[model samples]
Target: MSQIERGWDAIAQLDFDAALAIASRLLNNPHLDIRHQAYRMMGMANYRKRSVQQAIPYFEHAVQLVDNYKDRFSLCMCYALLGDMDRADRLFQNIDSLWGLPVECYVSIVMCYTEPKHFQRAVDLLEKIKLSYTLLGITDQTFLAIRGQLAFHYALDAVHYVLNMVSASFDTAKWIKSFAEEMDEEGKKSLALVSDQVCHTKGPFTINQPNSRLQYPLLCKIEDVSLFEEERILGIRVLYGKLHVG
Candidate 1:
């Protein structure tokens, strides 16, 4: 097997020292792909341990080889692990520069802070998004996400936060969905503008990412499963307007 494949094999086995040794050796490989892959192996292995600091350098190296959204998210997660939320915030703030990293970056920032019950800050960020969308105005805007026309992530995260603690009531989900729909054309244009700048591949940005979907118990999913009528009612009865306090 190629050294790169061997290195990855070791990493997949959770053999950090062996993986590191293999990675250090592959670092000197002539092929850029091999070099990049080595860094990913190193970074990913560390990430599996919930220790992002060690992942940072390897991901940074990957960026030096190919500056893209994927590498940036890897590095961004490292910063998040280090509790440098400003850096994390900044990365999302400038999504134009980090588009290909998939939707996780956007999702992760809000999740990292709010999932553990950081609602007020999440709300503040959403409000900021709303204000920005308003400032852009319809004519001046391009996409809703970027133009400050609407805060999709803001709304999405808020709904998610409220959802986890509350019962699987359509009322709560409906409220969150309505808030997203409230963004005016200008806001939508701004978001589109951001999307255009980030996604140049010409097509709707919708694809089933590989093992990348965040799992949530939305009412839609519950309904799809043919949840019994009583069970569904009970689910709705559970969480009226709750919060996670840790």
Candidate 2:
């Protein structure tokens, strides 16, 4: 196998050290694509290892070599994880072909937005994704799976926003009420859709903990299915009570 192929294999095996070592060897290669791949692999290894700060420069170098949405997305994720929302937002704006990205990519972007309390942007992106899926005439089950994931995140974000607003002294009663209703609706939708056999039986429904890397709460699946369901119900109940009580 080629050095790049071997590097990827190492990454797949969770051997970040080996992958980084192989990638470093190819960084000085004459071919631009090879160098770009090396840098990309290095970045991915570091990112997967949760050394997000160390991953940024490698991803930046990879993107400089060849500007692609995948590398740019990785870079944006690193920035978002580091709480540099400004840089992440800039990279997000520059990403092209939003409709062409995979569902996981969309989920990651939504998480990035919600991480920084940019809940409105997350909602807007989901609306856009739904419109795209409709335009593309995607399969019903596939659409439902994507919708379920989006609803979960939306409900989760709503819960977060309501809690923050309630803790603050601001007069957020109207906004809290609005989000409470929205959260309940979305939470119900999420529970129904995610529980559908067709939605969680196959595809990316079975979550795997590859390593110590951070996993998004909404993306938990399979073994955590019951936990997810309970959380959804609890969030809705808690938010409703909070809004009604005071």
Q: Show pairs that collide, candidate 2.
A: none
What's the residue-level lDDT of 123 in candidate 1?
49
* Candidate 2 CA-lDDT value: 0.55
lDDT of 1 at 95: 53
Give the per-residue lDDT of model 1 (tens digit) for 176-238. Answer: 334335444543443333333222322223323342222222211111211222111112111
**Cα lDDT tens digits for candidate 2, 1-246:** 999989877866668899999999999999999999999989987876668789989989998999877788788777766667678777776674452555445555554443425556766666667766666787544543333334344443233322221323333344323323444454444434323332223222322324312212332221111212111111111111111110
TM-score of each: 0.47, 0.57
Worst 10 residues of 1 by lDDT: 231-240
RMSD of 2: 15.0
Model 1 whole-model lDDT (C-alpha atoms) = 0.46
How big is the positional error of residue 227 in model 2, measured in Å on the Cα after superposition?
23
